[model samples]
Target chain A: MAPKYVLHYWPSIPGRGEYIRLAFEATGTAYTESNEPKTLLKHVMSCSKVGHPPHFAPPVLEIQLEAARSTKSRKTETSEDVKSSSPFFLSQTPAILAYLAPHLGLDGVKKGKNEEDPEVDQIRRAQVNQITLTILDLNSEVHDSHHPVASSAYYEEQVPEAKKRAEDLRKVRLPKFLKLFEETIASNEDEDHLYGSSLTTADLALFQLIDGIQFAFPKRAAALEKSGKYAKVFALKQAVAKLPKIKAYLESERRLPYSDGIFRHYPELDGED
Target chain B: MAPKYVLHYWPSIPGRGEYIRLAFEATGTAYTESNEPKTLLKHVMSCSKVGHPPHFAPPVLEIQLEAARSTKSRKTETSEDVKSSSPFFLSQTPAILAYLAPHLGLDGVKKGKNEEDPEVDQIRRAQVNQITLTILDLNSEVHDSHHPVASSAYYEEQVPEAKKRAEDLRKVRLPKFLKLFEETIASNEDEDHLYGSSLTTADLALFQLIDGIQFAFPKRAAALEKSGKYAKVFALKQAVAKLPKIKAYLESERRLPYSDGIFRHYPELDGED
Candidate 1:
């Protein structure tokens, strides 16, 4: 029997947890999410007691590989903290993706083909991971668009500064990042995927990035799409959305909408197209 | 022969490039740094032409591994771009660290011992990487203290808002992060390093973080250190500085001081101890 996979994150918004959710959805992996903020906070605070490293933020994936282990490991009984007997626990969205990629058979490395050269495959995966991190950087910038002055402060309080940052983001940063991703997709001779023929986590992450951007800045994203400068990125997003599992997930209730997550759509921050 | 590592970053300050330099120096790996901004800009602009992924920012490490390959890989002859025949060109500081770690033998995995179990060792490394990223998060927050409104804007322009952000950072965020690091160090049985008994990149990163904090917020950091709350984090800093290679690097001219990088010292931002 497969061990339970529990994802702990804020219940309010998709946030970073969505990336993990997308992977599980795309791969058809059965998992449960403990989304309550208080629940996540409790678990994070008590992480030390469970022998896991303390994470600064939420979106922690508590993996239960109990079946693989010959003996059961003792877990601290905490009423507040979300308890798990999982031998392995992971945090950091990109790191979580990398750890889960091999387990879900989505590492973008094939067995007997071009993946024959282990060194080449490792380098390729590193490149994919690099792309993923760059996308994450863009995501952080997007979040700052709404909360330019300070994250703790309300968007209403930071609206004045957010306008300036959003203008720069919409005019300069957005196009710059999109063009970079555009070229990345164009680099491959075959218009197959980000890392060649097979779909990798980068592709999934890129898809989510586009989705978030479109949700957060509809007018700007629409204009960029219409301009056709970043055709490859939009096309890649569409392709991922069309994936059977992904398509179903999108139509399902499991896929949450963008609200107060990293990519928030504060009307004032989203400048005119 | 080992490949020549050429680090590309802004010559003025010890930015993200410093992380890679610490790793190379700690491992005694031969490497050179290209300080010219024009060279880095050109390579970034022409990254696609050279059949490599485009990077938005600098701290690009171009490894010259031509000797290992039988054939020369043609590169676009750009007047401004830093040319390299090395197939691997990595951007993003953490990704660069991960890529270089295995080659330099500083990956923090002990062989024929506790590291005999590959699964356990990989998890441990993941944990180390997580801590490194958390330190990076702290680094970004420190950078934001000065440029809270917009990264492209000058500190003088954002003074009013920066004051508020810095106040929160110094009074709230700093203590939270330092305590997290302190607890992380306390979790380990041996007081040797951040990752259990072995020295990992996280230790080097934490050492750098503490150094940056001290440079950027002297009064605040001194106050925090004097409080004896983060004793473990300060102890780890001392442990890392005592490393023979690291000690030599610190005393040498190669070790650049903090300037306009992520961590900058602004008396106003520093606040009262």
Candidate 2:
């Protein structure tokens, strides 16, 4: 029997958790996701008390292994320790993805000796990781657009500053990041994927980023996509959208619409293209 | 002979480079660092053109491997291909530290089967990584205190908004993060290190963070340290500071002062304890 996997994340917003879901959906992996936001928050808050590794934030994946059955023979045990033996939990999105991708065949290829440039594999994977980090940085910048002065403060209290941040993100940082991604895609002349010939988690992440950007800054994302400058990026997004599993997931109820997420669609924040 | 390691970062500011430097200094590793700002910028800019992995920012580590010497016999001699064989570069501070820590013996121990809780090692390392990332997150928040509205703009342009961000950070966020670090330290029982019984890169990173916080917000950091709430965290800082190499590095010219770094000492931002 296949081991059971449970993912705990806020059900309403497809924020950072959506990145993990994309990999699972793309690979046709079976996993259950917690749907209650309050329960998810409670679990994250109490992660340390249960002797599980303290997760600073959520999108935690709990993996139940076959080895857990042996734990029944132990004499002295609490509920948490009993579960701890066979089922381990991992937190932090990137760490979880890196751990899972290798097992799921979604990681970069381990090139052979006969390959023309076998050394490029290490560098390729490192670059993929770098690009992924840059994407997260961009995601943070997008979040800051609305919460510029203080995350503790509401959007209404920081309207003027939000406008300033949105303007910089729109005019300066957005174009800069788009160009960087566009250049990376263009580097692989023959393939639509972000890394190598086959799809990796980085490609999936890139697709999600493009998707979120389109939803958040409709006018700007549309104008940029139409500009012909980032042709490869636009092409990759279309390609990812058409993948059979991804297409199905997008059409299904599982795919939550963008509202209160890292990439938010605020009409005031979205300037003219 | 060991491989030559060269670190490239901004000359004046400790910035992100300080994290990498802490590991090297604590372990007494010998590595050269570039001091000229123009050369550092040029190297970072040309990273892509050289066919090496492009670092989006500085604190790039260049490793020249002895294994790379075998490539001389290969017929393919493009400049990019030639350089790719002998020397490789890694960027992004967290990734660099993760890659180097194992070689420097600063990584967590691989527990034996006889150990009571062998399963804890994996969880331990993941939590350490999480803490390191959280430290970076705090570092970013500290930076935003000085440049709340625009990073591209000068500090003078965003003074008013910076004050608001600083007030929130000094009063709310700083205490919250200090409390988190304090809780983590207290979890280790009698140990002075952040994890297990010995020192790991996370401890060095924690030390750097405490050092920077003290420099950037002297009034607040000193008060927190004196209040005795974070006793273990303060003890860890003292322990790391007394490490022979680290103490030498601190008193030497190589340990650059905190000017124009992520954690700048703005008098207004310091506020009160």
Candidate 3:
């Protein structure tokens, strides 16, 4: 049997963990999420295995190797296989996505007979990561729009600062980032994809980012969408949404609703553009 | 001749470019900075070459291949070599560092005869990236401490919001991140490095992050340092500082001073712990 992919993250609110989920969903990869609060707390708070380092926070991806299968079929398995099959746990959303990209065929690199250029493949991977990181940076800024004063504090506590931040985000930062993404997509040879001809994880991330922004600031997002200034970005989002696996995943219950997470819908915060 | 590494960023402030510089300095790698404002603006604002995507911002790393040498030594080089040697430009600080890590021998992966395990090396690289991204996240938060309201606005405009953010940073986020780093260092087999036995780019990043925090919040950083709670983190900083290349780089004219960059010494923001 193949190795198991287990995701450890918060149970609710499609937070940073959503980026990892999109990668899995888009590729039709099988994975289990350990969202049980108590169990996840134990797994997240402690380094249960020897080789695994302590993760600062979750959306931790644990790749359980042969040991996971051997434990079920213990009588038939050899001790050597189990001994060598220690699980690998990796944290941080971008790191996790990058690790999974090539495996899921979402890295936009041609393989097999067509894989003539290793240099191009390497550059493509870097470009994918670059776009993903920039999208996440914008996501972080969106989160800060609500919790400007402190992440630890409630949004209500910093309403004034939140207004200021949301205003700047909608007015200045959002336009700047959106324009960049728009130009990036427009510049690419393939109109649908962010980097190469095929879909990459960067496109998936951008899809989720734009989706979240729309959810958080409906009026502003709608106005921008209607204006058609970022038609390429919106088109990419639509293209990603139209992917069979992604479409099914988004429609299913597995796709958690955005709530008190990074992208929250606060009426007052969603001011005029 | 080796390909030249040219960095494009703002000339005055260390900013995000500093992280890229530290990687080069720590490894004693030969690189040039295209800090001339006009030249840098052109390189940064436009995708001057084909195959290179437009960078959203700078601290762009341009690897001028055979053409850089051929331009000067046209009499010695073949047309084919120059034609194939297009410059590769990569942006995003963490992305740039990750790309440079393996080349600089700061990726914490063993090579040659001793490199028996490809899996371990891959895992080490992921761990190094995970740590580096986390430290950069903290660095971003440090930047937010003073510019809580908006990155575009002046600090004076958001002084009140800055105080709230800084207080939370000093009281909550700093301790949380510092403790995590402390525990990470303690958990590792090697006392000096974050992963494995040798230096990695993550350690260099952490050293810069801590140094910037000290610059931004002297009283708070001093108190924390004096308390010795994160002895290992500070010790790692000292260890990185004492590295001959890093030592020379720090004392040399190349090490730009902190001013209005991510970290700034706003006296009011550095409140009591």
Listed models, DockQ each: 0.43, 0.37, 0.44
Q: Model 1: runs farther than 4 Å from truth? A: A1-4, A36-38, A71-86, A114-116, B1-4, B64-66, B69-86, B114-116
Encode model 2's per-residue lDDT on B158-210: one tens digit a residue.
Answer: 98889888988988888777776776666553357766666777889888888
| C-alpha RMSD values across all candidates | 5.1, 4.0, 4.0
Top-TM-score candidate index: 3
lDDT of 3 by residue, B92-141 (tens): 99888877887789887867722544544566677789889989999999
Q: Model 2 residue A87 lDDT?
A: 67
Error of 3 at A217 (Å): 0.5
Pairs in steric clash, model 3? none
Candidate 3 per-residue lDDT over residues A201-263, each given as its tens digit: 899999999999999999999988888899999999998999999999989999999999999
lDDT of 1: 0.77
Interface RMSD of 1: 3.0
Reference contacts recovered by each candidate, as fractions? 0.50, 0.24, 0.50
Instruction: Quote each prediction's TM-score.
Output: 0.90, 0.88, 0.92
All candidates: TM-score of chain A = 0.90, 0.86, 0.91
Question: Residue by residue across A40-82, what tens digits does model 2's lDDT show?
Answer: 7665535365343345677888776534433542444455555
Cα-based lDDT for every prediction = 0.77, 0.74, 0.84
Q: How close is candidate 3 to the true structure, as a TM-score?
A: 0.92
lDDT of 1 by residue, B203-257 (tens): 8888898899999989999999899999989988998999999999999999998
